[model samples]
Target: MALTWIRTHDWDAGTWRNRSACRDTDPELFFPIGATGTALDQISAAKSICAQCTVTRECLEFALATNQEAGVWGATTEEERRKLRKSWLADEQAAAG
Candidate 1:
């Protein structure tokens, strides 16, 4: 499936954020400063929260749609999202063709 829903769906039209597992958690947990040591722990912790989230798909879609360049969203780190974004854009282009 595509990582983005922005093309056919309104990114801001849903209240899925209200149901996010990280809503009450520290926002900084998702935006670690580095990719190793403490940052890896933080990323793991954040992804754990995302793993239990019911809105994970929506969260990922929103992140991809908005080009979120930092933090963990939908159990994925920045690097993971970048790769997924590339594939998603490719899928979008292929579908358009």
Candidate 2:
């Protein structure tokens, strides 16, 4: 099958995005419900879907690289990503010192 391409500001056709399991799923699965608090059921559902995705790590890395502030990516909630960003920044600062 010819690979379906999606618009991304990051990597080009050379990346693994073509193989993403979330490619065919609803786009909203990666974002929060409208104006509603992030419910555990919703997060669990998204994470469960991500758990089986082959490109989960790539997706997470993309979110981190792009500083995505909202939505679920690669089985992680927004808060999780926030903590990861903090940790990554700390590691970078430590390495630079």
Candidate 3:
């Protein structure tokens, strides 16, 4: 037997990527190197940039929809994103039920 699964998202809507405030910043800022204080600072800095982004909502939606497991996105760190995803799933389940 053969089994396969596919993943998809509104890539066309990802036009926001072209305007991302972090686009010109060091990509490393979005990906903290560890759980140390320096890493937390990096995450904070990345999020600050996201705070000023006009496309922040789009960036967040895309990150959530894609279940991004790493890096800062839309002013949220990995742990924060995890919590948001959990809450979002709970909301979806409640709505569906």
Candidate 4:
């Protein structure tokens, strides 16, 4: 049996994107049903679902390995992961500098 890649969706394009891609995401996807409070709330709801998902670990691994810039996944917030990524990039830059 072949493994099926799961996507940690963050937005509309992602929600509707082809499932062929192993890992994919978008940070701007939001639910506009009714009077939505804010993007933050939408992200929070999505994160809650992600937390209970079966493929969360794999999703998180993929997001981190790919150095995803934004989107909610892997028990991490966008700002949190971005800071870590920036530092990693800085280290790499310094090593090459």
Candidate 5:
């Protein structure tokens, strides 16, 4: 899939949030304390929901754009997003150049 970069100025475009699969779910499920045992379970559960979400890309883009340091967005864990954010930033820079 092609990456779509979202600007901070467009953070207000949150209409897709209402259409998210985890909207009604527990917010804590997405924000785990660690990446082991129970946290892993939480991540798995959150990802399952994301897997079924139509606005997952939008959610992930928002997380990446806003630099969300925690939680599972777009089916990715905190560590996962951190690595992806680096690549995302590189890609954005390259695109801008």
Candidate 6:
């Protein structure tokens, strides 16, 4: 049971398999990483693709639940979520201790 849409978006979603999407591989392809701005630009490109995805909500939930500390999930970048998760973990540890 394979979801075609998910597979198609797999490349744009920055999945481990998609790391090369922006990088040309074929001997015939000659693309350049010439986007304006800084690293935010890369995140923006990935987010733009995720925005139109049908499974954005599901992706977001999975990311938060698994404490995913990498990649962009939903509209949130890994760095942004990392700070939030770190704060939550610290609070939980303090409460438990």
Q: Rate the local accuracy (lDDT) of all candidates.
A: 0.85, 0.68, 0.75, 0.51, 0.84, 0.50
Candidate 1 Cα errors over 4 Å, as ranges: 1-7
Candidate 3 local distance difference test against the native = 0.75
Q: Candidate 6 versus the native: TM-score?
A: 0.46
Which residue runs does candidate 2 get wrong by more than 4 Å?
1-13, 34-38, 93-97
58-85 in candidate 2: lDDT tens per residue? 6776776678888888678788888887
Model 2 earns a TM-score of 0.70
Worst 10 residues of 3 by lDDT: 1-10
**Candidate 4 residue pairs in backbone clash:** 11-29
Better of 2 and 6 by lDDT: 2
lDDT of 4: 0.51
What is the per-residue lDDT of model 4 for residues 1-97, given as tens digits with 9 covering 90 to 100?
1223333333223432233222343444423233336766766766766665655555554555577656665545666566655554555456557
- Alpha carbon deviation, residue 38, candidate 6 (Å): 4.2
Error of 4 at 83 (Å): 4.7
Worst 10 residues of 4 by lDDT: 1-10
The reply for model 3, stretches above 4 Å from the true place, is 1-14, 93-97
- Candidates sorted on lDDT, descending: 1, 5, 3, 2, 4, 6
Tens-digit lDDT track for model 6 on 1-97? Answer: 1111222323335554333232333312111133345555666767766666665654654565567766667556766667655654565456558
Clashes of each: 0, 0, 0, 1, 0, 0
Instruction: Tell me the deviation in Å of residue 94 in model 5.
Output: 1.9
Q: After superposition, which runs of candidate 5 have C-alpha atoms over 4 Å from their true positions?
A: 1-14
lDDT per residue as tens, model 3, 57-93: 6777677778888999878777887878876666556
In Å, residue 67's CA in model 3 sits off its true spot by 0.7
Tens-place lDDT per residue, model 5, 1-97, is: 3566554546548688889999999999999899899999999999999999988878887888789898999888878888888888888788678
Model 2 accuracy (lDDT, Cα): 0.68
Model 5 TM? 0.86
